[model samples]
Target: MKKRKIFFVTGARSEYDIMHPVLEQLQDSGEIDLQLVVTGAHLSETFGKTVRNIERDGFKIADRIYNLLSTEDKVGRIAGLGSQVTALAHTFNREKPDIIVVVGDREEAISVSLTAAYLSIPVAHLAGGDIANDGNIDNSVRYAATKFAHIHFTFLEQHAQVLKMLGEDEYRIFNTGNPALDKFIHCPRMEKKAVQPLIEFNIQDEPYIVLIQHPIITEVENAGDQIKETLEAVIASGLKCFVNYPNSDAGNFAIIENINAYATKYPDVFHLFKNLDRVNYINLLRYASCLIGNSSSGILEAPSIGLPVVNIGSRQRDRYSAGNVIYTGYDREEITAAIKKSVFDEKYRAEVKAIRNPYGNGDSASRISDVLKTIALDDKLIYKNITYKVF
Candidate 1:
């Protein structure tokens, strides 16, 4: 049989790290021909010029869609989606790929995957049926992406079951584990000192907290206030706080401004980072006292390494979690209490350390690739029955 041609679409700070191994194996192995497409933050200037990072890591980008929205407002976001879909439609026609692979539920990923779906290309949707950030399009994006795609490649077995409950074809859905966890399990925990240079920190001596908040798309106006509460909580707790930048959402600039101002006043207390490439991120993540964020990493990536997470607010509101997570409102006191308890409580820390990740082991990339090769490519691939939601 001839090799299958798989095209991958990624946008703005989704877990590109998760796909690293999958892409590498597909490219290196003779069975699959890979065509990678980069859009979203990969092409944005305000987002650390991240596209260069994609190329620096060594993968072929077949399409570079240029649509950088200034304000993180719904209008700009929707417009950008319109532009991206148009550009990728051209790319798909030229590439004529056998299958399209999209990861996560970011707006850009949804747009690209939708483009592929409209063109009648089979899509392999990863990280569907997970929950987080109530206002975030993540839940809607993931679920909607699931509707358009053929294969469901979820990060957790529980998530796969949820997809089946949501009416996805059980035969087509496979629990490949999270691609992000693959990096965590495969690589040695990066010594805190080894990653110290990435941040201008004296973190080699003691523990620290990592902040990774994304702008709430639904409440774009109050983002500055929410970010203030997050910062105040970190400062009030007196924990060594490492601030990771937010994603390129409508109100992302406000979050950036808050981080910049926070960096200036706190000095050593703040471990400033532009952005971390995936491996260094997972490595350092293992050592953080606790992750303070509304991002999905807390629910999905942190637990695999037995890392503790203090998830704040509606961002990750109703998500599944490992035993290591502590949920609290975004109020400074609530955030502070959660952080202090998760980090300083020795007995609790030991309990968290003993808990294993409920998500799968490290064979996700391989298993996902195995199914991509074997699944039939026909109308039956695209057509699926909607299983009734059990009340």
Candidate 2:
């Protein structure tokens, strides 16, 4: 039998990390030809040019789309999305892959799905049906991608049901859990001493926090203030912090500015990083006293490690959590209280450690790979029908 060519589009470090396990499984399969298209923040120097990490992982790059705009605002973001669509259309026309796979609700996922739909190509969208009605603009983008996607690989059964309500055919949707959890589950925990050198922090003896807050698109003007509140709270907690850079969204520049300012002002208490490979990041979470941020990592991966999360603002408001996350607003006092509860409250900490992660069982990659290998590539898969009943 001829091998099926599968194209996977990854735009940022976080998205790539979530999709890595699935990519590995597909690449190792004898019946599949995996093509990875690196684009968005992966190709931008300002975002640490994470494409190097992909190369370091030893996956052969099929193409690179330098579509990210230097301007960090809403207008620039839209322009970049348009550029991605144009670039991907040309690449897809040249490659003509049997299937194109994308993950999450970022611009990359929607751009690929939209372009593929226009070209009559089947698109497999992972994490399509998840909801995070946190005024981040991604919630709407996620649903838009679902409409264009031919196959849905959701992380939860509830998410799959969201696709069904969105008119997606049931046969095309698969509850493969989250492939991100596969990496977290199998990753061995490193001792604090071992992790300290990697993150450049002395965390062996003292408790610390992992902070990863991002800018909310709907509240772009308040981006700087929002992060300031979180930083102040984390600082007040008196725990050393390892702060990761926010994603390349519209309001990210403001968040980055605040992060840099905080890092400079309190160099001893706060450490800033552009990026960390998945291994270091997972281990960082494993040993952290608490995680403070609105990044999806807090909602999805942190719980699996039994890490308490103080999810600030609305970026992940409606997303399902495993009782390990504490949601708070943008007020510094409220944020500080949440952090206190997450770290110093012994009862809360114990309960969090005992909670089982509902995300996945670490086999999502294999399941997704199996479906990709066997799902028939034909008109039935390409032409989608609404599964909704009008009566």
* Full-model lDDT for every candidate: 0.80, 0.89
Report the C-alpha lDDT of model 1 over 232-342, residue by residue, as the tens digit: 999899878888888887778888999889889888677667667777777677778899888778877777777788887788887777778888876999999999998
Error of 2 at 249 (Å): 0.9
lDDT of 2 by residue, 240-293 (tens): 999999888878888888889988999999998898888899998888899988
After superposition, candidate 1 runs with Cα above 4 Å error: 384-391
lDDT for model 2? 0.89
Tell how far residue 291 is off in model 1, in angstroms. 0.8
Best by TM-score: 2
Question: How does each model score on TM-score?
Answer: 0.94, 0.98
The TM-score obtained by model 1 is 0.94
Model 1 pairs in collision:
12-41, 72-250, 133-315, 133-316, 167-387
